[model samples]
Target chain A: MNIALFGKLIQLLIKEKMAYRGDFLLSAFAQIVSYGGEYIVIWLFMKRFPLLAGWTWPEIALLYSFGLLTYAIGASFSFVQMRELEGQVRQGTFDNLLIKPINPYFYLISRGFNLAYVAHITISGAVLIWAIGQLNVQWTLLNWAYVLLAVVSGAMIQAGLLTAIGAATFLWVRAGFLFTIFFRLKEFISYPLPLFGTFIQLLLTIGVPLAFVNFYPAAFLLAHDSAPLPGWAMWLAPLVGPLVYGLGYLLWTSGANKYQGAGG
Target chain B: MDSFELHRYVYKLPVNAFREQLRFCMDLLSVGEFAHKPVRQLSLGQRMRVEIAMALLHEPRILFLDEPTIGLDVMAKDQIRQFLRAVNRKKPTASPGRNLPGRSLPRASLPGALPDERRYGVTTYMMFAVKSFTNQLAYRSEVWLRLLGNLLAILIQVEIWRAVIGSSGQEGASLDQMITYSILNPLLLALLSTNVSEAVDSSLKSGSIATELIRPLSYPLYLLAGSLGLSLYKLAFTVAPAFALAGLLFGVLPPASPMNLLAFVAALLIAMLMSFLLGYLVSLLAFWLMSHFALSWMLGGLITIFSGSFLPLWFYSSGWAAVAEALPFQYLGYVPAAVYLGTMTDEAMWRTLAIGLIWAAALLLLVRWLWSRAVRRLIIQGG
Candidate 1:
């Protein structure tokens, strides 16, 4: 990707979004309220139980906020593209992307950067800060580095999943139902994995591997002394995101090759 | 009982009256053979005829037929058209309206011959509602998607509640009650909520609002009627079946008592109307704002939080509860569920119902006032 061109595209989109500032602000507030409502539900539950499966309120908040942060970042870049892939294919617009000099995947991902997800970042960032303040963890340079690495890996995992789902549109023509199911499943990783039964736990861990996106990494950083996962598994969680993302990218390429256009 | 017998029982009609109406319907629609069969076993056209007959059993003043010929063979269409014409000729007072946009007039000449005095009334709104109900039948693919989504949502909630309640063994609310509340919240929201705001916003964007403005009826009311029709359809076809299935699978709690069930139904109706008014109010804001998407989202967020859809009001702090009570959002979801669960006392239920009615009346006025202003703005802007 041309860094300058990507920056210009983002700038232009921002400008366009700003033209309807009132609508943008209202939508952003709505997004904030949506996430805020989820946090409040968690808070209310924490108040009732004091601890969820062995995790405290602030710890759960940290896990959820990290998930939200990475989801927002990934979605800001890829959501529209992923959602519109079917429409573009039906309209023969995907052919234009393939004809471009740039890598089509990167180009598709770079275009249509949604600034509305700033609301997600703001709300989740606040929760993360509050949770950290509540925790007695001794933060060092290594811990901070690990947190940074985990956040990026989480974003990659989200982007990968979305890309793969978008690629499925080539065969299905409309992958919206699949997207909805996956999105609902993604909501599971925001809390402590132990609260779920073994079946769901295994499903999230290995079936879709959403646990590697937020839950396991956060557990390692905050509660390593009593992390639920095996010791090696906790350490290996960060690598799972990139590995899943790489597999998803390969799936997308293969699906792209198989695309014979809507006429076919 | 078959559909015919069930309709008679539900309507509390005398045996002779019910038989006469059923015979008239069957003879008119040529569905006498299918009348004895279960509704589920009927083919689409056969079911449509039965539904039309059932809808006419009450002798409604205005009859609305929405795509009455949809999915029918050519012969079936001709039969339905002939039956409708015969019905129209028999009841001169009841104007039978068919929503056929582009097609030439049928031999019946219903819409064109309707007098000006009969053009606007309760019957017209009822027709709009019926039209909306039938329109939703076309989207068969959405039913599975909606069922899956609702099922997933219920499962997630059940799991979360089980985990939370498991820790303390109990909370502010009992586990069973909480589960019931969670189940009803989404079901009611799905049944009551409307995309009217988005619909109005899109019409405004596409410059179709101009066509609506030229119509004799009030645009907002038209939208409301249409939404009511859509809601009724979903309640019957989607929400009811989904709720039944979910309840069977998850074991939902029944209403606390017969009285509570009555109060819950009343509260639910008021809540749905209030939701429609709120949606209309939000959409009218599109007149001033360039886009309504953000505003609609913001309204959704407010509803999600204040309406207690995500969490029951009892779970909130007293201070937060007071704020929520002061607002109209609680009437949308909380009051009805609370009443059904018998969480609120009889006095509180009455008070909440009273408050809900007041809000509905107030919002209705606001919607009317804002709609006039929106129309004026549209006129000024040449929208």
Candidate 2:
């Protein structure tokens, strides 16, 4: 909503983050090692076994990267705002937003443009790039543009889900469980969609559409598009991101209205 | 997204401080540069400044703080000292040039009494444990969701293990054993990973570490007892229910035999103590290091791999398994689970248990030494 302000906030966070030069370096190393360990678990297991649902190691890595890339970008901004909503609602402090002259959404998102995710983005981005190379993905201009759009849309899907969850806090203060459930589901999407049973596949595709965040886009990219959803749906990143985020915004508006009407 | 909880706390005040007022406080404290930074990004001095601003934002007549400058450098402590003095002496600023005096006591929350030197008995620590157990009971409404989350975690692991093992059955560990392994990791985690590091870290920050250390009760024992309370609570509520659900939905294999079950129980208790000891060992480093992030983080990685929580030792190459056996981490995660599966040979079980006892004793001695030294430093330097 406010491009300059968002950029400015990001700038300030980076500078502040770098102020702890030694600590940051140590923690970044630890962060990489920690996340790398998670991947190592998968790698170690897969090394001994056959392909999971016919999905190779590199292919699985790509899918996992898509999930991380989307989350890193989306959560780099919206993570704090979304989690903060439940507390604000329960404490009756969200009214500060309604009373403010500035758009609360912009204020909330921009203020938390966390630079902590620099590690996540770099780690995931490297993995995604390496996976793409390993898979020999044809990098046509249109394909490149499509990849970019999918990444962006995947991020929106994450942020939109979080936003809707946050907005629902306006209706019920104890909407925190949704956040936990949403995160657990995010873990599920790191695998190929069809690796799961029909129920889970359906849940990912329709119940929540978490598939669009990684599974489907990844399938489309690798040309192994045997997902539960149709072929064209794999390319729906641009539409889904905004569509979900728009719905979240609508929920926010209505929730805000009810909160104000109740004099809360 | 990392701004301090200052905004939320500020807004939660009975009287909302206008955004303009917040800006004024930020400027006054020279915390202007920190307005958008996450709390984690801030230096000790910077965070202290933000804390001061948070307190001042509500325009409270009296301010109470606990060890605001406890970990600050000389210059930063003096700056905070000067700021508090100035604020205390200044006229009420909510209205300009007011005759009313502002009541501010920055070190007000510091406990006054520190006389008890009597050592606490086991019963006293048990009371502490019971308190810890009841502390978690306040969130009854959230219990079901947490249970569901636990169940979901179990389901994810079960499916992955099934898919991996179903097609290509491994050596001694069959599909049933593998399923049991997947389900047990979460159950053990819920029962044993008591977040001892966080508990100890917070107490250190709150200045309660001084009191706990000075008391005759062994602080580590107290922590162990407290965490034991937490584990029991988890078993009764979260772990037991989730285990039942998982057992019903996706069958978890029973122990290899009656003897294996007995050994498994013994190993589980040992595993609990091992994890708690390791957590305490790392967390106590905060005294010398002031932050335990890197060490605990390193240990977490080691545990994930070496402990067989990520992959059972059976799945690993024999060389890798041998290397894992060389470390104490296997006791924390692998030994108990393996014993339950009856995969561990009788001789191996007895041998591992013996070594595990030695490791536990060694860690207890190490924790006691470090904690005593930490207490000495705290008292001498007034941490």
Candidate 3:
């Protein structure tokens, strides 16, 4: 794909959304309120109980904010594309992507870059900062660098999982249900993974590896020496994102190759 | 000893009359050979014929059908149509009503005469409700998806509550009560939740609102009936099953008293009406707004927090609780669940329910007035 053409597509999408200024603003406000509600729930729970699975209110807030930030960035691109893929596949409109000179996965990802996610990122980033302040963590430059890398990696891991799930539409024809499962599972990592039982902890760690998206990195940043997983696992968080995303891209390509028209 | 016998055993009708009706249905629908098979084992067409036979056994004056031949083969459709025509001929007094507004009118009436006396009325709206119920029934996979999601949500709630209460309980509710409250919270909300806003938004966008206007029924009433049907279907097939499963796994507590159960049920029914009216009012904003997406999200957030879907209003500060009590959102989910849990006294339950009823009435009038204004705007703007 040409960089200029991709930039032009993004610009056009933003312009189209901006055409309905009232609707866009309303939608953005709604996103803020919705994300804020999640935080309020967390805050209320913490108020009721000072500790959630051995994490303080500020510590859990930080984890939740990181999860929200990564999810917002990842879902800004993948969620709508995954939702629309079933219809596109069934209607045979997906063939248009294959015929384009650009890589279909990149095209698909770029086409659905929603600006509304700015609301989520802004709100969650603000919460993260507030949470850091409340916790009074002595942040070194290296710590800040690790936080940045972890955020990028977390976004990749989320986008990769969603892409893999979306790829299933090519084979299953009705893979929308899988997206719901993924969404619910994503909610699991929004808090300390230790809050859950062994089964869920293991599932998030190894089965889906959602822990790398938020829990492990947040635990590391918070310097929770009693973190449930092995000490070495925290250091591996950055690699998980690129590795998972690479596998997801491969899955998308194979699914695209296997794609037949609606007639099939 | 066949399908006829099975119907006889199930319905407890006079054997001779039941046999005659069964034979008539079999002969009319050309499914005589399938009579001996169990209903579950029969093909879709054969089962549909049996269902029609069962429905007509009472021999009511009007017969309502919602997509009676959907998913059937051409031959099956033809045969079913023929059978319905035969039934119409045999009992000319019995009017067979199909749910599609203008389709399946009598052959004697021309296309222009589509607005017959039976075009719109209570029965018609009920038909719409039944149509929605059957429509939901068709999406079996969606039901499973919803069930799985609900179960997972309940599990998460249980985990959260377990962590919060942890060998002690909060004020006004024990751990057992909280668990029961969490399980029933979603059930009550699911029963009241409607897609009216989304439906209205899309219809306005697609210009289908025009067709709805020309129909004999009021557009708002039609939407209300359809949404009611959908909620009922969800309550029966989705919420009840999930509640039962959660109860089995997590040990749900019983209502504190029989009176609480009665009051809870009444409050729940009123809450469904109140929810539909609120959703309808939100949906009406689509007439003036460019899109309802943001409005719906705002409404959802308001309902989630104010209605106390995530946590009980009692947990909030007194000021917040006062605000919640003054609003109608709490009546949608919180009040009914509280009544069931006996968190509210009998007097308090009655007072809250009376307020809910008043809100429903006020919302109904408001929606009706706004609908007229919307219709006028549409006409003036040629929308």
Stronger candidate by lDDT (1 vs 2): 1
Compose the digit string of candidate 1's lDDT tens values, residues A1-264: 499989988888888989978777777887887778778767866775687767889999999999999999878777788899989998898999988888788788878677888999999999999998999888999888888888888888887788889889888877877788788888788777776678878898888878888888877777643234685676676687788789888888888889889883
Clashing residue pairs in candidate 3 (N, C-alpha, C atoms within 3 angstroms): none
Best-to-worst TM-score order: 3, 2, 1
Report the lDDT tens digits of candidate 2 across residue range A1-264.
578877888788779878887777777677667777677777777777648777888889888888988998888767888798777776667777778777878777877676767777888889888888888778899888888998888898888888888887877677888888998888788777776788988988777878888887778877885667678887676688888878877887677677743233
For residue A49, give model 2's deviation from the true position in Å.
0.9
Q: Please tell me which predicted candidate would have the highest DockQ against the true structure.
A: 3
Candidate 2 chain B lowest-lDDT run of ten:
B95-104
Error of 2 at B92 (Å): 37
What is the lDDT, from 0 to 100, of the residue A126 in candidate 2? Answer: 90
- List model 3 lDDT by residue over B46-118, tens digit each: 7888778767775657766767777888888877777888888998989987634335543221123222344
Which candidate number maximizes TM-score? 3
Query: How much is the TM-score of the A chain of model 3?
Result: 0.96
Poorest lDDT segment (10 consecutive residues) of candidate 1 chain B: B109-118
Residue ranges of candidate 1 with Cα displaced over 4 Å: A20-23, A224-228, B1-119, B167-172
DockQ class, candidate 2:
acceptable
